[model samples]
Target: MTDNSAERRREKQPRTGAEQPWEPEDLVISEGKDPTPERLEEARRRLADEGPSAIERSAP
Candidate 1:
């Protein structure tokens, strides 16, 4: 069998930081509820103003 342990280890490693810049889509406004346009816009604005902290601030 091919040894894939290294790949598995890499996958299990914690991310050093965000792979890409935060986007409005990254926000989780509610559990089952889909975010509205206004909420998305708010997330966009928050991302611009607060950076990644916006995600924490907007989390349910």
Candidate 2:
């Protein structure tokens, strides 16, 4: 390429060339409970505060 620094920067990006068609309706997660907006918000908060271990805390 014209500039080595520009090529390096492009390589460090998080997104890849191939990706799925992103859609909000496709996200349907349930922890054995009804998919309510409040429950989803609580789960998000728990995950952010507790990290990956939060998933295990949910009852099957």
lDDT of 2 by residue, 1-60 (tens): 366997899788755311333121122242556657876677666665765445544423
Clashes of each: 0, 0
- The best candidate in terms of lDDT: 1
TM-scores, all candidates, are 0.49, 0.44
> Candidate 2, which segments miss by more than 4 Å at Cα?
1-30
Q: How many angstroms is residue 45 displaced in model 2 relative to the true structure, after the best TM-score fit?
A: 0.2
Model 2 error, position 53 (Å): 1.0
Clashes of 2: 0
**Where does the lowest 10-residue lDDT sum fall in candidate 1?**
25-34
